[model samples]
Target: MGFMSGEELVVTLAPVAVYWVYAGIYEALLQHTTVLDRYRLHSRRDEETKNIASRKDVVRGVLLQQAIQVAISVAVLKLEGRGAAAAAGDGRAAQPEPFLVAAARFGVAMLVLDAWQYFMHRLMHSVPCMYRRFHSWHHRVAAPYAYAAQYGHPVDGVLTETLSGAAAYVASGMTPRAAAAFFAFATVKGVDDHCGVAAPWNPIQAAFRNNAAYHDVHHQRGGGRRNFSQPFFVVWDRLLGTHAPYALRQRDGGGLEVRAFKPDPTR
Candidate 1:
């Protein structure tokens, strides 16, 4: 809330930084190993799915938006009356908060973000011009990879990512420390949603409904509609009658093939 000391800034930035590294490792492991290949929703990867330029685009967008979030968070925390400026090495205040404090507030923040993002995503799909001008950049990857989550147009990125997280953090009744936790968890979940694997053993998929397979349907829907929510829970799409049911059927040789059937809106 107050001016971020160097140490506080480090704490705030750690989530974004750590998530990137973890996602990179996971992405490579999934690609190089057969242990989880059975979970590849679409056996065929797109030309741009793992392109270096695409990864750079995603990284650029993520870092720029994260910088904006850091600046905005200072103000948000201040408004919450928790942003107290600390003097360097003054020992007058704690250096930074412990992790549990951040974790305790993460769930509320996640729910707020997911709800806001669900509506925003549907709105983008509904507007033809909005989809063409911005959201379509993300949909280019019919079979998306982990880093592809952030590879979106700048305008869309600001609206969906930055705005979603900021609003959620504020609405969570969270302190600055908790905001950091929210960012970290969000970054990780976002990548996992687009990671292109849906192993039954994956705890993320098991814990929440929005697994990699869940989001893969969103990317590969091949239509401009349905399965719009990201990260966790297919709540909005289910409520809106737009959540399609999908299954992986065994092919003649043995691999799995994704098949999505539109849910009858009238049902």
Candidate 2:
């Protein structure tokens, strides 16, 4: 058997491919044109002046993390004998899953991923050393953009993203193909959350409550201390009292911006 082939390759690389294509589209729209200006959560001035990490640095960090993800995926496939079994023509033909079953698995995966990310992400912030060493790199982008979604310390990425994904897949009992799809969907969601655009017409944005505006709050100065749930539901945040409520208001110039508000004490 070659090092990796068939479903193994797809499972390993599909999410990475999806991440770049989705994020690249946002990069092109945000950087090359003024068309999306009205949808932007922050002004171009904020993106340029407030962000500490350069584009080059963000790209390099994402690439490194992706490489690590791929390596870990390959290792998992080898250990599970999945690649070898497929290559050897094991008699078990791939069976089509029932639609309802597939849906259930997807739902379970989302819940598992959200719970894992919520707790792990919260822990990263709760502990000062972990935040400084692992998570702070991601916070460098005060005015986030699409491609900066995965820009973080590799160790942080492995702990929060890579392992959480694996846990979701294992817990949901999803097939490799389903896991691939889930990961790709997650990549798109993560990129959208950081796109810094709250385009009302975006279906993905409309479908999920934890959209760009919600995540943009976490990237702000004081806002990082709350809203730790990510890329999916806000159940954990709400339950844990970490949900920083925010309102999206029209910017003075054109677009929209997120302003977090304190909840009423009596109400």
Candidate 3:
């Protein structure tokens, strides 16, 4: 995979631009809607205990991770004999042809990442030691907000996100451009999952209604295993019998609640 100057630009700028736009739109929605406000997990109950990290802090954290990743990816590209350069048009190629090719590759990478996230997340939850010791920092945000998505135990973050990216690079043989786009999508999905709004038929919600609900339950319950998947897909959960049933009998007073699955205490 050899990239010219234009491709490199596309690979670099696309993720930042897309995610920034998404964050703005999501925050605006939160400001205006009471329904969206109610969806926030911590609400006033835990507000005093919350640290409420700023958007600048969140961006800084993400950039730190991206810096490390870029260094590693550069090394990998070199070792693989794949060279990357800046793209000509808004970081794309001078011609429209290669851009389309790269776009398809990005689409495939996103699906592959969704699968990888499901596997790794499930493993983290099922493996108790890993979950309690390494993954707990993420769950500490009882009520998650968009920026809260990347708040991870450093080791856990590197292992799950960075290592996964490295593996995807190897497995999919993705170009820098495609990998860049994939990262953008991944970041947006993470933020959206933690955004705390549950609009039915919203594209993100539609992508993972069960997932958002599962995670919400995890927070509301204060301690429990649920939605051990990320990047918004439930195929693996369905396959592995971890998929929580979504339907609930409506109460006489109205409003739906998730039916709890009885856990085998023997485990």
Q: lDDT of each structure?
A: 0.70, 0.88, 0.60
Predicted candidate 2 versus true structure: per-residue lDDT over 14-126, tens digit per residue: 99999999999998988899989998998989988999999999999999999999998888777766456656776552665789998999999999999999999999999
Model 3 lDDT tens row, 1-267? 234345555554665566667766866766665555544434433433653444466567666666665566556655553333323233432333466666666666666776777777767767899988876666666665665667666667777776676666666656665666677777778777766555565776776654455555555453355545566566665666555544433433322334456333333
Candidate 2 regions exceeding 4 Å error are 83-93, 263-267
Specify the highest-TM-score model's number: 2
Query: Of 1 and 3, which scores higher on TM-score?
Result: 1
Task: Estimate, for each residue in 20-120, the C-alpha lDDT of model 1 and write its tens digit.
Answer: 78677877777687766666655544434533345666678667766775665566655544435343343424455456755556767777888989888
Q: TM-score for all predictions?
A: 0.81, 0.95, 0.71
Each candidate's number of clashing pairs is 4, 0, 11
Winner by lDDT: 2
Q: Candidate 1, which ten residues in sequence have the lowest lDDT sum?
A: 85-94
Stretches of model 1 off by over 4 angstroms after superposition: 1-3, 6-11, 44-56, 59-61, 65-71, 78-81, 85-105, 251-255
TM-score of 2: 0.95
Query: So what's the TM-score on candidate 3?
Result: 0.71
Q: What is the lDDT of residue 192 in candidate 3?
A: 78
